[model samples]
Target: MKQSKVKWTKSVGWLLFLMAIGFFCLQIGYLIIQPRYQVEYIDNRIFYVINMLSIICLYMALLFLLTWKKIWTVVVTTMVTLFIIVNVVLLVERNKEVKNISSISPNLQQIFAIKQDTETGEAMYYRSYYGILSRPKDRLEPEIAGDYKIEWLANDIAAFTYEAEDQTIQQFIGTYGDRQEDSMSYYYVASQIRGKWGADNAQVERQNNGIAITVDDQTELFGWDNVEQFGTLAIVLKKNNEAVWAISLDENFVANSEEIEPTVGNISLYKATMEENDPIVLAYQGGAF
Candidate 1:
């Protein structure tokens, strides 16, 4: 008589093994896409707990298989299932990187809060805006140079970061269709720095991904939409100069119509600065007509 041993089917065991292989394969791929933590410090603690749990699950599955336990299939299946879930989570989101850099005063006179750059590992950062940095060759065409200009001015904030050279600038008195290359700094400058003086009831026009608004009788500006609200003009003003100006121009080079001075200073994209009868320093942060 042939005794029948526990006529156990290896099918369940094979299925679990295959599932485990798939889960681990995906897990390996996920690790590649995940960001490596350079510092041991972690932002979230729950994630660490999840990592430990996964290892335990994997271990229990192998033990069940070796013992020929009836629940081995379920245990292994759970392991693969957990792996699939964890792998998905790992690919979904990564941590943001942080870094530090030196803080130079606005006038470029002195340095503060020195730190290393995350990307290059170099020690460099920005503080104050002196006169806009320009290469000698970056000057505009002679004819176009008559309208816009970049130069230094005095400051009110008295902080190192607020000591940027005031850019006293002007633009072509019309909407822009084509971008001017040589005078791009004027355009960038006009859009970035802001003027505070303007009638609240102003004409704000927006077109072609550009913005234009009138601050008052004296100032207006054309700008790139994305950077306007980024705290550039306000930050610069608060840091360097005591006198402040701003313009709330529209996205399409349109004007605003309010009773108040829509502009922050003398103009919008076109900014003029004064320091106790000093020469007017105009800077343009965006495009011109």
Candidate 2:
């Protein structure tokens, strides 16, 4: 019975020692990687607290596994306790120096935050790809200050407007996905056609949810629910499940041509049923593709 009890204590001590070692390695790995790539912690204070607890576990394991002199054990425990307290105070003071303002993308796939130093009023922005574990944070350039306003231009594009120290309004664009490539699957045509287009006396605006067609002084909305793409060249808008308008890309316009801007393309719109009306040629003015 005595031997079994001793063995059990040793096993528990080893388990605690292994856990403490694992925590130590994790902290070391983070320190090494942090300079090259900043990592976003879910809770910065909790991380330090966890490391402090791991140290306590290591101390307990040492007491359980070995018979140490009373004076030596007291010295080690005091040193460990002081180290933890100093670290906690430092972390708290450091955290108090910065104010964070964060915004998440519409798709919830990305996060952007501005960390402003309270003492110096200096600021920097960071972007992180949202995930379960700690995510890599990219620090962006153009140091800014003052309050900020965030607008989602699209699902993946964010526009940040703020005032500089010079009292001028500055704008920063944060884009998440690939702008040059069509990475999305379903909205290939819609994504390409999104933006402002102009014909004779009419204007057309294609957006994420729908398209707005303006003729003379009147405007009509064609919801995405009623729009269908036929092949890669054309899209038809329907009302009451009946095709009303057809928009087709200009035959001269080449799709996926590196030389041409994705947002700069020509298209034609006309009645789907009647060929009597001459097709209106529209040129892309500006917008996301």
Q: How does each model score on lDDT?
A: 0.32, 0.64
User: In candidate 2, what are the lDDT values of residues 1-289, reduced to their tens digit?
Assistant: 9999999999999988998898888778767766666565433454577688789889889988999998998899899989899889977876788665667776777665666677877666555543412443434233455555665444454545565566444445454543233433333455566678888787778876798888786888999898766435556676765556666665444354332455655766655432234567889887644
Candidate 2 off by > 4 Å: 38-47, 100-114, 122-289
Per-residue lDDT over 99-126 for candidate 1, one digit per residue giving the tens place of the 0 to 100 score: 3222333455533222222344332222
Number of the predicted model whose TM-score against the real structure is largest? 2
Give me candidate 2's TM-score against the actual structure: 0.43
TM-score of 1: 0.21
Which regions of candidate 1 are displaced past 4 Å?
Answer: 1-19, 27-54, 66-209, 212-289
Q: Please give the range of 10 consecutive residues that has the lowest summed lDDT in model 1.
A: 133-142
Any idea what lDDT model 2 has? 0.64
